[model samples]
Target: MKVYDVEGFPNPARVRIALAEKGATDKVEFIPVDVMGGEHRTDAFKAKNPDAVVPCLELDDGSHISQCTAITEYIDGTFDGPLLTGKTPQERARISMMNLRAESGLLNAVGDYFHHATPGLGPDLETDQCAEWGNKRKDVATRTMAYLDSVLDENDFLAGDTFSMADITAFAGLAFADFAQIDIPANLTNLSAWRAKVSARPSVSG
Candidate 1:
């Protein structure tokens, strides 16, 4: 397998963490796709993923898998390692719900505010910015942080007791939030403590 991604970016980081968690990082090749250099926009790259996104997983047989969660799911399911998604139906549902909330409520909101309000990925890639909409989404992202803090107050992990993809996604979201100048409020102690725990994980640097 070949993984195409840029280092340090949020989505790619999510995939990398998943790969590490599945113990599959050594089984694949890492291909750096330079988003800032517009490498992802090329026709050749587009052939693999029309969406022109990074963190794409290309199988040995030339099959392509896009979307971070889908790629993570594939890796977790295929590899013989710790499961990040879930083992049972109930667990899957809970993890998936928390995962979506982390993605949409925090990750996507931070991304929207960065791309729409601020100049994200440089001027060439950020053409249609809507400051008004972006501002609203920024507020949403902040609010979501507070909500997540409350959630963390109840449990160690986002989905349940074990570390899962929801935790990984939220970790990536918080990193993205930092890049977007969206700081987690100082009062959100639970969220901060959770971030500390997740950051210390070995998979985070994968």
Candidate 2:
């Protein structure tokens, strides 16, 4: 299998962390994509992933998978590791719910703030921006942080007691929040402590 992505980017980092947790990091070839140069928008690259995004997965059978959630699902199913998705229907539904909340409410929100409100990747790549919408999304990110903090107050992880893909998504979201200069509120102590604990995991610390 192969993964096309730029290292250190938020979405890509989520997949990388999932692979590391699965002990499958060494099993796949990593192909670096020149996203900053607009290579991802080219016809050739878009053929593999219509979304024109990074961290796309190419299977051994010549099929391709796009989007972090889909790629992580593939990884969790194929690799032998702790269940990152879930084992039961209830667990799966809960993890999926939390994962979506983290992706849309936090990660994507921070991304909008970075690309639209700020200079982002420069005028060349960020051709269109809406500061008003971006600022609004920034507020959404903050509120999601508080929501996750409250969730953490009741459980060790976002979905429940076990470490899962929801935790991975939220962790990467917070990392992006830092890069975008979006402050995690000082009063979100549960969120802060949860971040500290997740950071210590071998999957993230490495």
Candidate 3:
């Protein structure tokens, strides 16, 4: 399999985490996409995935897989090992729900901050309302982080005791926020503690 990857990005990092978890990191080819250089917007890249997103998993069978969750699910299903998804249908549903929960809270927050406050990606910065929206986005992101921290206080993993795709998504998504100047404040003690555990895992690096 060939993986179109990009560092310093949330979605791609989730794939990387899944690969690391599966001990399949070296099994696939990694092609780095320079997002800052607009490589993802090129016709060549778009031909692979019209969405022009990073972490495109091109299978050996000439198949392409987009979306971090879908890619991870495919890997967990096709490969034989400890499944990142749940064992039962109800468990799978719960895990999916948790993953979406993190998306609305953690992912949206970082996006609101990055696409609005950061340069090189904002569409237009000339409007006052845009500034107001940016501020609001930052607020949502911060509060979401806090809310997730509380939710995490009761469990080891996002979905349950065993590690699931939701945990992978949450860990990588939160890592992105940490890189974007959004410090994990002291109020989120559970999150800080959980982060320490996740970061210690070998997958967090590769």
Candidate 4:
């Protein structure tokens, strides 16, 4: 199996963390896709993912998986190691819901803000063009994370006590927010501790 990969990006990092959790990192081939240079938009890469996104996976069987969440789900089902997707119906539902919340709320918002506001990564829009949107997005991202932190405070993981895909999703968003200079407040200690734990994992460094 091969992983369409990147560095200095949160989505790829999420897949790497799932790989570590499943003990599958050494089993798969890593194919780096350069995102900073817009390599993902090249014709060759568009052939794999028409939208030209990073962190896609090409299975050994010739099937391909796109999207960070889908790739992690494939890893969970395809391997026999630790499961992040959850084992029971209720667990699956809870984790899936929370994962969606994190993806749509914290992750996407911060990414949108960063793409339009951060230097050296975007098209350099006029300040009047994206400034308000960026500021609002940053605010929403932080508020969403605070809400997520409260959820974590009540449970060891996002959905429940068991470590599941929701934790992976949230961690990716939080880490990405850090890169965008948006972070959960220090008062969100539960979320901070969880982030620390995930950061310590060897896969996260990738």
Candidate 5:
């Protein structure tokens, strides 16, 4: 398998963390994509992933999978290590719900703010600028931080007692938030604490 990505980017980081958690990081080949150079937008890369996004997974059979969640799912199922998505039906559903919430509310929101509100990746990539919508999404990211803090007040992890995919998504989201200059309020103590704990994990800290 090959992973096409720009290392250190938030979305790509999500998939990398997933692979590390599964102890499968060395099992696949990593193909670096020069997103800043417009390599991802090229037709050749588009053939593998029409989305033209980094962190795309190309299977041995030549099939490709885009999106962090989908790539994580494949990694979790194929690798031999701790489960990420979840084992039971209820666990899967809950993790999936929380993952979506984290992605949309924080991760994607930060992305919107970065690409639209700010001069992200320079003038070449960010062609359509919408400061108003980007600011609105920034507000959504803050609100979601509070919501996740409230949830963490009752649970050890985003999905439940165990560290699952939801935690991975939220952790990456918070990292993106930091990059976007969005601060997690000091009042969000639970969220801050949870982040500290997650940060200590080998998958992230290593």
Candidate 6:
């Protein structure tokens, strides 16, 4: 498999982390797609993924898979290792719920603030920015931190006691938030501890 992504980007980082958890990082070839240089907007890349997003997986047979969650599902299912996606139906539903929550409330919120409020990528890429809407999304992202803190207070992980995809999404979201200069409130101690534990994993550090 060929993995196309830009290093340090949030969505790509999520897929990389998933691949690491699946023990399949060494099995695939990493191809750099220069989003900063508008390489993703090229005809070649658009053919592979019509949406023109990175972290796309190209199979040996020439099939392409995009979207972070779909790519993660493929990785977890095809590889033999620790399962990031849940094994049971109930676990899958719970993980999916929390994962979507993290995606929308944290990750997407930061992305909106970055693209709409700040000079994201550049003027060429970030058109139609509205500071008012961007500020609203920033506020949403901040409130999400508190909600996640409460969730973490009850359980060790986002979905439950075990480390799962939801936790991975939250981790990636927080990393994006940090990059966007959004600070996590200091009062959220449970969320802080959970982050510390997840960050210590070799998947993130290595």
Prediction RMSDs, each to the true structure = 1.0, 0.5, 2.7, 2.4, 0.6, 0.8
Worst 10 residues of 1 by lDDT: 197-206
Off-target runs (Cα >4 Å) in candidate 2 are none
lDDT for model 5 comes to 0.94
The CA lDDT of each predicted structure is 0.92, 0.97, 0.79, 0.82, 0.94, 0.92
By summed lDDT, the worst window of 10 consecutive residues in model 3 runs over 120-129
Q: List runs of model 1 lying over 4 Å from the truth.
A: none
Ranking by lDDT: 2, 5, 1, 6, 4, 3
Instruction: List ranges where model 3 is wrong by over 4 Å.
Output: 120-129
TM-score of 4: 0.91
| Cα misplacement distance, residue 65 of candidate 3 (Å) | 1.1
On lDDT, the stronger of 1 and 3 is 1
Output the number of the lDDT-best candidate. Answer: 2
* Backbone-clash count (model 3): 0
Candidate 2's residue-wise lDDT over 1-206, tens digit each? 99999999999999999999999999999999999999999999999999999989999999999999999999999999898999999999999999999999999999999999999999889999999999999999999999999999999999999999999999999999999999899999999999999999999999
Model 3 scores a C-alpha lDDT of 0.79
Compose the digit string of candidate 3's lDDT tens values, residues 105-140.
777667666666665153443222345566677777
Clash totals for all candidate models: 0, 0, 0, 0, 0, 0
TM-score of each: 0.97, 0.99, 0.90, 0.91, 0.99, 0.98
Q: Give the 10-residue window scoring lowest on summed lDDT in candidate 6.
A: 119-128
Stretches off by above 4 angstroms in model 6 are none
What would the per-residue lDDT of candidate 6 be over residues 1-206, giving only the tens digit for each residue? 99999889999999999989888899999999888788899999999999998889999999999999899999999999887889899999999999999999999999999999899778988878998888899999999999999999899899988898888889999998998999999999988999999999989998
lDDT, residue 55, model 5: 83
Q: If candidate 2 were superposed on the true structure by all CA atoms, what would the RMSD be?
A: 0.5
Ten contiguous residues with the weakest lDDT in model 5: 16-25
Query: Which lDDT value does model 6 have at 56?
Result: 94
